[model samples]
Target: MIGFYGDIVFETSNSRILTFSELQRSTASRWAKHEVIGKKPTSEFIGPDLDTVSFTVNLNGQYGVHPRDEMNRWLIKARSGTAETFVIGNKRIGVDKWVVKSVSQMWGVILNKGEVVTGKVDIELEEYVERL
Candidate 1:
């Protein structure tokens, strides 16, 4: 298993074709600028901003992946506002769990019967911090 988001596992096998690539991570620090009297502005560090992760998944029918079903599952999670653990190779992604922020899909190949033969999906995830 390469990684997992909650119960959804990212793997490649004879029965399932789910693999991700172009993985990217983003993080930031909160800063505020204050104007000084007759002087230059000063910047103050507030705190760390929430981290985000994004990746692209290639789905192909030949590899046993059902694009529509996978897409619906991602949409469901995004709409439910649920937080899930994000792990990769036995390591957690961020300081806390994560939530599905957005999902974008593109169908590269489609059959005559309207079945997606090949597709690409982009997923965005954001850190989920619980209230202290």
Candidate 2:
């Protein structure tokens, strides 16, 4: 199984699309390995300003047993390809973001401390940027 974390962008050309990434060398390395070698390594290269798709949790209040207003944000962009999802850890909660966590021909989903509830690929995007 192989997975990477970064922002994906896609461009349309003649009814076709091209994908690009703004990821770190480490994530890029892992992606390359999976693309070329067909195997997953143990670790990945970590760098600065790595734009990988991740979930941000806002821990405002509430503690012990039940929490209060836990909102998860998904940072998605254009150009990202298909991905897979998985469930990790002990907590079980409905996921709003596309979850792809593992090493396979499919994209892997990442969990905070390996705590996943449910996951799936959500590929839907609209043009958000224009250059004139």
| Model 1 residue 16 distance off true place after TM-score fit, in angstroms | 2.6
TM-score of each: 0.94, 0.17
The best candidate by lDDT is 1
Tell me the tens digit of each residue's lDDT in model 1 across 19-56.
Answer: 89999999999999999999999999999999999998
Q: Report the C-alpha lDDT of model 2 over 4-110, residue by residue, as the tens digit.
A: 12232123344433222332212122222224366655454443222223232212121111111111212222223233231223321222223332211112333
Worst ten-residue run, lDDT, model 2?
A: 62-71
lDDT of 2: 0.26
Give one clash count per candidate, in the order shown.
Answer: 0, 21
- What TM-score would you give candidate 2 relative to the actual structure? 0.17
Worst 10 contiguous positions by lDDT, candidate 1: 11-20
What is the C-alpha local distance difference test score of each model? 0.89, 0.26
